[model samples]
Target: MVGAFHGHAHNRRCQLDWHPMYIDGTGHMEGEGCEHVFSASNKLARSTRHASVFHRHQTIEEHFAFWDTDKYAALSNFLRNHYREALTSIHTLTAELSVYPRLEWELAREADNQALTTIPVGDLNQISAALSQARIRVDSAYAKLQNAEALTAHVEMQLQVEERWAIGDDTYNKYKQETSLCRYCVALDELECLVVMHLFELSKLSLSGTGYKLRQQIGKALQRRSEAIQNALSCYNVQAAALDPPRPSLS
Candidate 1:
């Protein structure tokens, strides 16, 4: 009796794309171009090898898994998340610190203007007391702004540490190879450039304020010069009239 394997073989036949062959005991075949019997078997083996090679090439994740442990990748991922959180917090704190100082400056300017402009007909002691109280309040606000600036500095230092750790030399090189560029370094560089630009703008604003103050001082000097010129011209006119000859009486 034929077994199940024999029945399965009996059912198999050459497909439309395959050539059939019959071989004798002397190893000579008579069929459509079946010159060597082992060639078909060799082709089948080669096809299997090619399939395995293709599958191996396609499984890039598996290839990397064989060489790289997942723990390092996991740690890098965690560090990236933490670094993002820290950076965002630091940015917010920095913005607050920058704005707070400007606010205090505005308040101080307003207080000074009010103190200079307000006129009191009453006792001088009352006016002095009110001005002193206002100055104290402005000083307290300025101190608070200073404290915020210090806190922002501390946060910035912490952010710098984390940024360095996250994108160290080794990590930066590895990221360049893995992702074709160091995204963290790019982001940090962009932020640093922006901060520098902001600093430049702040410097320009300071210079502008100083220029305005200088302009006011120059205007006061010009007013004083105009008054001196008028006084000198009046004195010259009086001296010239006193020295004038009495030519009209002879005519």
Candidate 2:
């Protein structure tokens, strides 16, 4: 199988035929060589070079045992994060592809129209294009409004409010709870994305052969990301606290 780095430069056919991710049973392996392991093990050479054969073997064994244990501890978290990432990618791609059919139909119609006659472009065409864009924006805004209204109506119905909804009333409290839950969920999603991105950036910094300048840049980027993560966490906590049964705050 092609290594993860080189696979990207290959043609689509080569990738499909040789990339580890595309190949069955490869699972999440990147198809890269053991360069990272070799680099890490190189650190042990300074201590092992003068040691006895027995001590060298023991040290190597101990090192790898610790490595394995650490990896095992993190395995579940790694799998869960990757699974979420895969699902997010799939969902995003599916949403993007949803437009393909309408686009194809539009293309087909245009082709048929062109085949019938060559149309001239003029002010009328520009007006029609502008109008189409305006219409699309209006439709999008209307959809958002409808969604908001539906959510409000659903909350109201669920609370079964017959009297005036005043502050501190049960109906008002339930409405706030619903809104708070939605905000909390949104904040949690944002926090997860930020954390995943921060970890991914940190991992890149750990890779062997990273230049000093690149490492410094990554350090600066991480500092900014840390601030962002803190802000997101604060937002999450605020939303969580607004819940009827307040959630425990994260550190």
Candidate 3:
């Protein structure tokens, strides 16, 4: 089974076949074994860069030996936390499923019923019936002329004010500023979810068991997402500048 983190990066169609969520007997393993060790040992590269092959090998072996001891020492605490997390996830999912316990056939039938209701009629029978009633009301002597005149005036006012408010108008500009502020807020929210959450996850990641190629892929993803972050930031700043009072732009 693919590791949870790598599996998430796969295409949605690919996930159905490979993701741990869809796979049985995978347990709760993140499959990040020894990645934490590899990340911490990056500093060793500087010291070993000039060393002989024997010394380099010795340093790596020593580091792994220490890492294994530390990992074993914390094994109990790790297992305890994972158990709690698994229980919490199971309970939450169970509650949600209970609230909306729908079967596949039920959902399919509901969708089919909705599709049938939406099918358009080719005739104007409904429209003709409505027009006939409207004509009768208009011909009635007791027809409320005052109410009709008020409605007409209201519609004219709307056309003059709401419909005619062009780009340069104050009302239009105010709404435009509001829209930009909304976009800025949405962008900030996305950044928080993507950057902050990913950073926390990466802090606990280990790449040792995942291989060098996987490490390179993760590195490239980091670089690529940095560009996306920059673009979002740029968009935020642009929107900020368009605000009514002009929001303070990010550095």
Worst 10 residues of 3 by lDDT: 112-121
- Superposed by TM-score, candidate 1 places the C-alpha of residue 74 at a distance from the truth, in angstroms, of 43
Candidate 1 lDDT tens digits, 1-251? 22222333442222111223211131212232333433433434422432566674555445446435654668788788877877875766665547557565656556655655665657889888877877886888798789777776776776675554355587876654544224333433554554454454445444645577555654564566556545544444443333323112100
Which segments of candidate 3 are over 4 A away from where they belong?
97-251
Error in Å for residue 65 of model 1 = 61
- Please provide TM-scores, in order, for all candidate models, with all chains considered together: 0.20, 0.35, 0.39
Per-prediction CA RMSD (Å): 41.8, 14.4, 17.6
Measured by TM-score, the strongest candidate is 3
lDDT of candidate 3 over 45-93, digit per residue (tens): 8568557899999999998898889989999999999899989768645
Cα lDDT tens digits for candidate 2, 129-241:
75775676578669768866766665566568566679999888888889999999999999999999899889979899878887997799899999999999999999888
Best by lDDT: 2
**Model 2: runs farther than 4 Å from truth?**
1-164
What's the distance in Å from true for residue 66, model 3?
A: 0.4
- How many clashes (backbone N, Cα, C below 3 Å) per candidate? 0, 0, 3
lDDT of 2: 0.78
